[model samples]
Target: MPPSPSTRSQAAAPPRRDRGDACPGALRLHQAADGHLARIRLPAGDLTVRQATALADAADLLGDGHLSLTSRGNAELRGLAEDCGARLATLLRDAGLLPSERHERIRNILASPLAGLDRHTPSDVRRWARELDALLCASESATALSGRFLFVLDDGRGDVAALGGDVSLLAESAGDGAGPAGSALLRVGDDPAALRIAGPDAPRAALTAAEAFLTAAAASGSGAWRVRELPDGHGLTARDVAGALRSAGIEAAYVAEPPAPATRTSPPYADSAAPGIVEGPDGDRALSVLAPLGRLTVAQWRLLTAIADADGSGALRLTPWRGIVLPGLPAATAPDRLAELSAAGLITDPASPWHRLGACTGRPGCAKSRTDVRADATAAVATGTTVPAEAPTGSPPSGVPVSPVGVPVSPAGVPVYWSGCERRCGHPHGTWVDVLATAEGYRVALVDPDTAPTAAPAPARTAAPPAP
Candidate 1:
């Protein structure tokens, strides 16, 4: 069994120092081999339909026609020209996407993408997430947080919780009048146990906790920006975090142990029959959609805009899993609209190829990559390989796909991911098959959950492979 939340402990290590983090943003673009790379922070992954359309337009006008999704639930516009930052910033600002220039990069927040929409979730994690973003943006010192710093808000489920956040607030059931129906448990590093605070105070408490972390990191003289990198002696404690919350006027308590949130393997998708009615706990429903491989062509992007125009009432939630959910649609029009989206290759089914496959900007877009991993993965998929399916409660068995093309890939199963090099960007969580590029060609490895890690020998191929 996975370690319970209460039993988890922080690592003991001295703090390490760093000058500062240089993660780029819309305002501060990073020059890549292809062009400029600009990451747009979508706190709680919320974007208006207009905002989504603007991003698509930006990609077409200032960067590549394609958009890349970050593991942090942010969007990346690559292949941008040298002079596109100011233009891009202005465009996003007008669209209500760029709220704070200084805080844009540091505005890293992940929440339950399907919260309020998913049947099993208790509350809309988006509300808490937005409140937290507002708090962070309003803070004068929050600019100190590195662009890479992350915050996760899970609604009593272990989805985003598994992504390994720097500061996390997992929601739990609460008592009436004690607080909202849910409480927030704060976690630092990978520790299981966390400090609990009122649901209403969760945003404020999280801000205070982050401030405390920054102060500790500075005091230790370890220049560490991330909680986990803090040296042994400089590690944070639940008691210390509780004290910080109290100082900030937010009530908090250290729980000896908290229940480990359950993990949900299924990705969010629209209910074809119900449409806007998102399934929640006890047969409830919500509006949800997937961004294929988290990349959208201009045409596909337009389709999303059309859906938003027809179904979404001016709001769309960008999920941390690189998808979108539109809440409050008319039940009558939703099914037909969802059908249109499904016809366009958006995965509304729990099991779909787009949900299972993820790849980085390899080859032409990235100078460091040895091959176009995305193209390669697409080629592999076309070969009719039977993508892996989600394993049962027991340990997963090992094997490669039997057929390569037209097979549904399971997000929770050991699916295949291609990398330009050893740095496998956008790699999926849980079990997976790794195909790494080398000077001698691709090296295939099957990651096993039950035994020591080992690599599978590459299959012999003809001098020339089939066209992708």
Candidate 2:
């Protein structure tokens, strides 16, 4: 759980950094404890099969023979040679993955992964994601945005609405005005208020909201790197952003204190631990596949692309959930293709113990990690000590053996995140079960929805110690 609005305002803040964020990009690699690391941002996580193949090639040739899917729908390559940046960049550019070097770091966009594919969603927010990305890249003011700045386009689904976006456009339901086609609600940061705009104006309004943040950040002169980083009294709001939109010649209507939808839900097929096949907007069916531990070996990558090209659309959409969606599949061929995926060791069953589990780069990859969390998590799963068959997605499974220190162990089934340490990098937003590593063992905690996002008492289980 994260801090509430009031709690955030009153909590102590970390010291301001003297330098800009050093987040890695395709061109600018970061020297991690493991090796050189590069992050490739994929707007709305769209990738052609050919592009994915190229990435696979690059991973084998320049990286550690694997790809890591990030929480923001980006792809990461780790354990690269010091001189691999040039070759990596060339391969990515040839594949159309690197569209703009200057704006690459700023193209942080998260769209509803199932927007057009699911019938519950009214619009294909991915289109708006493209428009917004192009606009942001074209605007000079956007260059001032930090690499951490994020834009979200949730297609009326709650899947990504709570993702802590700096600027967000949530699709409106029919009858919410604008028109029968509905409109979009623009919200800046965590403000309860929002701005209503026609669907057509959504992209521009989102950009304007970002620009407004830049303006306020400059006015405050605190060098705020994010919306929440501004001085307490100078924080931004929906009204200020709406005014900014008006100044930019976009009509904006302020919806002061909008009500949360009574029954907001995640995208359809999101819960299944098995092969998830959904109908696309074009009347074609698509297969949603999960990559265990958010990773794919180069061989797995090539296999996925091959499947997409042969049996489904020639495209792939990488989701923030660490899943890959191969849309545009012919309905008749779905079962066969899905079998191929499952045979290749990819997760295809919703009830699978492997589904919805995550681990950080522990052991040799990260110096800060107390243990090899990945290996420990794997052992926990292999020994039937983790994720059971009956738990719902995102909930903690119970009934594992207690730690040697006499702590009670929860059963494993629900979505659980394993972090090398307490930072909990790459953990999903909202409620989740957490497994944090400690020198003594692993402490499992359920994030209490009632409490202000703190680790509540659960059980402690000893992860198998690293082999000598």
Candidate 3:
């Protein structure tokens, strides 16, 4: 059996949430400086060619013609007219993107982008994601989950599992000598221990754990939107999750020792899958490419959609790395299509400076922004002078991207995020370069996200190391 939540203790307590989360959904639009923004949740990032076309048409007909791919493998439409909400909903409904209006925002689910498509990992996690999504839509009690609440499904590749989800399901290989073949580990919050259950029962176990979180959150009276925010004394453990799973009629075993850590050797939260071609089964291939800064023009979106519709499996998998996976493409034409994508400004090379680069919507889109951070970040990358070739590799203890030696890491090796202000919205989870726009100029420093999974409010600006 797994240890109970009482067995563990935390040093820090997250602040109380006084109000409900205002995260925008397909039906509920968030009013931004540019205009109203709509976030369309795509479970497992799976979308057919027809659905992809619908999104492109919606972008062209309604809001800005650009679709923003989030770090969680979701998409957003900005600069939308508030009155167009009804029309947008109609378009989405017709495209079958909006399955349940009430459960749309809560449908935030991240899975292995290349699961079952390539030979690296043939786990059927996409099926699990779809199953869990349907279960959430049917459960009225699950409507209470916050939009930020995450469900990470990793197909033993350790890609999405390292994302630190509120409820995580890591796929275990068949006959791996761990437990029964085709089983998975269900993790809650930051606790290392997880619940092991049959593969088919993993989705149900995940839902049960989520429902359990809702119950614990209500009892805390803290209005916490996620498990990470359940306060120091309100933590949830694998034992609690196992009991909940049993109540739901799903068999589960506590895994005090989960099969090796689910983290990729390739820098945490960085380019998960390499860019360019990914070899698939039966001599076929898949094209994997990254979007420069996570923004895709309508033309670029259409290009990818066309490839998926004609050359590939008529499907596209939007990865959490702000990239796209075109599966089952012919080994012959896929390379040419990749070249077209590269010419269109997408990052096809893993060594490209734009691999891990990210920026928030600044200037006109956000009223709180002091400058146009997107443009500045772009300009910095264009120059290729963001980092010194001979600069020191080790970073200071306070904050700075550095090399792995002596706990320090290379500054260039760290991802860079351009923030308009201190809020630093949509920043990457791992250590990164903090390029904050100040009154004088850009304040470039190193920043590391809080290791805890809690959703704490942004801290006040404080003194930091000198800019590099």
Candidate 4:
């Protein structure tokens, strides 16, 4: 199970933020040891061929030769030249990637990447994501939101429901003894209660929910940048948010109890040990491609574009799993494309060792890192011993057991993430295997049910000291 909102969003003893969030954006770059880092938020992770190609060009020309996929389904360019911001901005602008400079960082939205293409989804909510993005950008008050604030649009499959969204719009099943058909359940700040509104009003309702949070945060006067950051006594309720929705001309009524959050699990398309081709009901298909360690070279990205151009809709959706979903492909052509992608070093088969591993950019790029975590992760993956035993049920201290350091754990394809230090940046949501770099070596643990690290006394057999 995922952690509660308070546990997930709030650090131990909530710290007040007197300054704005330092999250990087296309316009605002972060100076890293590698170079400048720029994050480009793609609303709903929608990327056209032109925009993707433009990003590839920027990566090759203005930044590093590769693009980094973020866990938010956004893209980041590292090793960026110090003076290339203007050119990069112009290129992104020309490709329609940057719509609002002021609202760029605040546009952190993650939706079901395979919403429309998947058969199990209730309805396509990609349009809702776009509409909500536009609404958020249009609202001048929304500019006050911290870049860390997030919004999630789920297509009733729960794939993205547990991703810690500050505001969430989940689709309700029609004719299932639920209120009205096609109504969206809008909840703010992980509150179980929701504001039920027509499907068409979901975007406006989400915007209104943001406004309500902003209002409450303002009242707290704690400079709360997110709903969770507001003072403990602050109240967030469906009725209050519904009232705000009504003021925004979005008809919403309070629901005493909304449906329980969608189960947090890997999408069916990726439930196996490796990502594979997803065949739709109508013979349409999508090739699920994973980037090794969430890093893609320009040539590899171009290869993806070529595959999409040849076999898909020329559209790719970046997933929060640090992967790319190429939708609208003919079922017949998917197999060949997957083969080609696999041959090109992309993880197309779930059984591949790369299927279970991910890592944060550790050394060189991050000044705080004690070791090159990515290199260590790659070495771990190469050993095929990355999977860990099931996560323990209770909260425990965070560290690996040194008593049985060389014990071999069978492969279960459990998701394992390597972090440079304690922060565990970009770790996957839900229960996952965690490997943290430490002075003693690497500490491996399965994140506890409470989302705290529960480390055994021994590291897995694959644990290796990070390269200097």
Considering only N, C-alpha and C atoms within 3 Å, which residue pairs clash in candidate 4?
273-350, 274-350, 401-456, 401-457, 401-458, 402-457
User: Model 2: runs farther than 4 Å from truth?
Assistant: 1-11, 175-180, 261-275, 281-283, 386-414, 456-468
lDDT of 2 at 53: 88
Q: Write the per-residue lDDT of candidate 3 for residues 1-468, one digit (tens) a residue.
A: 112343234334565777767778889888888888888899988899988998999899998999999878888888899899989999999999999998999998999887886766665789999999999999999999988899999887777776658999888876456766678888998787888889999888899999999988988889887787897667788898888888889988877877764444365545556688887867888889988878899999999999898899999989877889999888999899999999988889877777777788888788878998777666656544222345554323344332222122223456667778777777765456666677976655555444432322253222210000
lDDT against the true structure, per candidate, is: 0.67, 0.74, 0.77, 0.75
Off by over 4 Å in 4: 1-11, 261-274, 386-413, 450-468
Please state every model's RMSD to the true fold in angstroms: 6.8, 5.6, 5.6, 5.6
Please estimate how well model 4 matches the true structure, expressed as its whole-model Cα lDDT: 0.75
Clashing pairs in 3: 402-409, 402-410, 403-408, 403-409, 403-410
**TM-score of each candidate structure, all chains considered together:** 0.83, 0.88, 0.88, 0.88
State the lDDT of candidate 4 residue by residue for 1-468, as single tens digits. 125554445344334666666778899888888999889999888899999999999999988899999878899999998898899999999999988888999998989887877666643579999999999889899999978788998877677777778898888766445767778888787576787889999988888888898888878777776676677777566777988887878888787767664443454224311378876767899888889989999998998887778778988899888889998899778888889888888888766667757788899888778899777666555454321345343312223221233211213435667777766677766566667788987765666445444642121111221110
TM-score winner, 1 or 2: 2
Error (Å) of candidate 2 at residue 291 is: 1.0
Model 2 TM-score on a 0 to 1 scale: 0.88
Better model by lDDT, 1 or 3? 3
Q: Relative to the unseen true structure, what is the C-alpha lDDT of residue 405 in candidate 4, on a scale of 0 to 100?
A: 36
After superposition of all CA atoms, the RMSD between model 2 and the true structure is 5.6
